[model samples]
Target: MGISKISEFDCIIFCVYAVEYRTVSGVAGPLVILEKVKGPKYQEIVNIRLGDGSTRRGQVLEVDGEKAVVQVFEGTSGIDNKYTTVQFTGEVLKTPVSIDMLGRIFNGSGKPIDNGPPILPEAYLDISGSSINPSERTYPEEMIQTGISTIDVMNSIARGQKIPLFSAAGLPHNEIAAQICRQAGLVKRLEKTTNLLEGGEEDNFAIVFAAMGVNMETAQFFKRDFEENGSMERVTLFLNLANDPTIERIITPRIALTTAEYLAYECGKHVLVILTDMSSYADALREVSAAREEVPGRRGYPGYMYTDLATIYERAGRIEGRKGSITQIPILTMPNDDITHPTPDLTGYITEGQIYIDRQLQNRQIYPPINVLPSLSRLMKSAIGEGMTRRDHADVSNQLYANYAIGKDVQAMKAVVGEEALSSEDLLYLEFLDKFERKFVAQGAYDTRNIFQSLDLAWTLLRIFPRELLHRIPAKTLDQFYSREAASH
Candidate 1:
């Protein structure tokens, strides 16, 4: 048994704990090997007392009878094998959570980095939460408008769905992520009116944003933007900078998700959890795997990478009788823009859909540069039309997709054969494509558009083609929206 002392006002308190094993036989990377230990459980918390009387935190990674390997959260740089004292806490890692966590800033390990008072937690949730069972989940049927036209009109995000943004290294995914944080919501419209209505507090919308392996400058940008936009009051920010201990990266998303679950399932708040640069999280897993000398899978990643990712991604869903829901948008940068990379390829299988950022459109100075052709939301059909978004949403989305696809094919042909050789009908499609890119896809950084405005803009663009060419749209929809004056112009 170990005895620890705490000093108070002119008094001392002694606490008893489990045996402190002082036989740390080896220290390698972030792991410490302790010999002659008994009854160590996997994932149990371990407190390592240094020679200076300070302590470092770790979790037991593996337990082999009388021996155990622990992964230290603060790393093992100054750990001394001969003098370190390891005390098993007999509990797994957990973080304190409450509704008060909103607007709070925390490090990857769930400690407060902001200059504020500590949280009086309502409960301490296990960091490694179990996935929601598929049989208990409800199908996603509500739309989440991001206020970005490409995502709102073309590939609409649904509540409780897990979608991802597939970006490259240099792509402006950070900016896009911040924008979504500021603008995403479950838009409410007045009965028999097109005007947007503000949902009551019962709607309970919130955001849980986690950034892993980002630099300080990037972290500041996220904080400043959220504060300026008045979103900080409802946002919970978890930042893991590049300079912090690498092992903390493995815990950042889990901590963020646990907080989200608390807010959603307990507080009845609809939560949107955004995880940026998932590639960093994966890389951290690779480093820990290499340290353990585990057999490597594709690209030197751990073979259980898929299962690990599932534990995180599968946490997003609406329980059968719960009032709140968890919707996830996990952003990952594809190495060399290769979607076939192990990271993105596996994500595609687990996630419902993906939103691909276009490098070509970015070069043209487009703000978001979302490529509409390849981007999709599998649950969009279930969430749009009559009561959800608009009656014309599905038709407008279909028409826009068909026309833009044809316009792109014509553009490729123009490069092969001169524009002069193209028929007059082809020229009209070429012009339609130009207008579509300029008017529909492009928007200002802070420009916010509701579902009505987005649908109106799609109709304006579709009018460029003759009414006969608009075969994808229904006749009743055309008669209502396709005016002769707009078509002639």
Candidate 2:
């Protein structure tokens, strides 16, 4: 029998072989326990019928002989042990996916909430996807331009890489995530040069966005932004509102990634999956663990948090012979801005690298507010260079970083002593610092820059320092791009 028919609990039997247990021994939060159950498989789907005939769906979290614990997706607030009936469907939870899922919005439980027609399933995929074989996986090399200078020029994100945004509360991580979704696309390389504007086409790209435990305002903001920017046509959104059941948050990302995998591998489209506020997801895991009475680890979080996160992150990549690829950009808000928090700490170990959003930069009115010092993309080197971006891309990036580091140091020194006490070279470094933050790092929310535009702006800031002081840049590259007259006094 189908899930649609099973939802109507009036039927005595969901399936011919399905067993019904009227003995619900316990109901704690979203979990319900069934005692004296037999032959129930792990992860099996269950339907609970209340006294009023209302039905809720659940999955077996653990099964031991004739006892099973099921996690109810809709929560068990009013469920009574005496009146509740648990029906085992003998099937696992599966999400229906189709190419038409683009432009559609789904709730945390994978149900359509967009007021659109129900999804005509191309196939029902298990949310727990199979891990890709290591031998069959291909290395990521092609760069995906986010149109944000801080990301594209400095820490480049390659296709099929799993990179995350590290932010804290009160930051504009949501805005940044939305901007990237609207502007991200493949940067077609033109003839061994790093100039991205001359001849490049945005590839056929798709986005699967999942928002966990976000408020109504945030949800509407994303929906409106996607629609306004015309990106909704190529995007699929999964929203788990703040009032949604905590258990549903745990299933949201899996459904999103499963849809992404289908779109990437089956439809031959480059899919970008953006999961925001993973902190809420982790909280939900902790809540479930607490309900299950499992032993708590760091900060009352489950000890298996690292392995659990990996199951989601490792799903993003390219198979050797597949025509499409899946890339992930997960955003997590660090509690109290602690980088060492178990959430981001464990994430750092599993993912490629992280992009840290600084609160100070945000307070300074910087658009992206990304702190370049602590942020890095481990896969950047493989995706940029001669014939990819430009031959001088690497050297220019290094020089920019080196000069910025010195500029910061000089700023500290200037604060210690008056500006007049500093030398001319130190004064020039300070000027470079201002231009870097204003012209290079800071851009309008909607302003999208090509790789060439970003590099040109970098050169403009670099020219503030005398060529003699540019120790990080090679002499050959200096001759090609540096003009003697452009150097400041």
Clashing pairs in 2: 194-389, 194-390
lDDT of each: 0.89, 0.89
Residues 39-108 of candidate 2: C-alpha lDDT, one tens digit per residue: 8889999999898989999999998899999999988888998888899998888999999999999999
For every model shown, the clashing-pair count is 0, 2
Return the TM-score for candidate 2, rounded to 2 decimals: 0.94
Error of 1 at 28 (Å): 2.1
Error of 2 at 421 (Å): 2.8
lDDT computed for candidate 2:
0.89
- Model 1 scores a TM of 0.94
Runs of candidate 2 with Cα error greater than 4 angstroms are 1-16, 192-200, 484-489
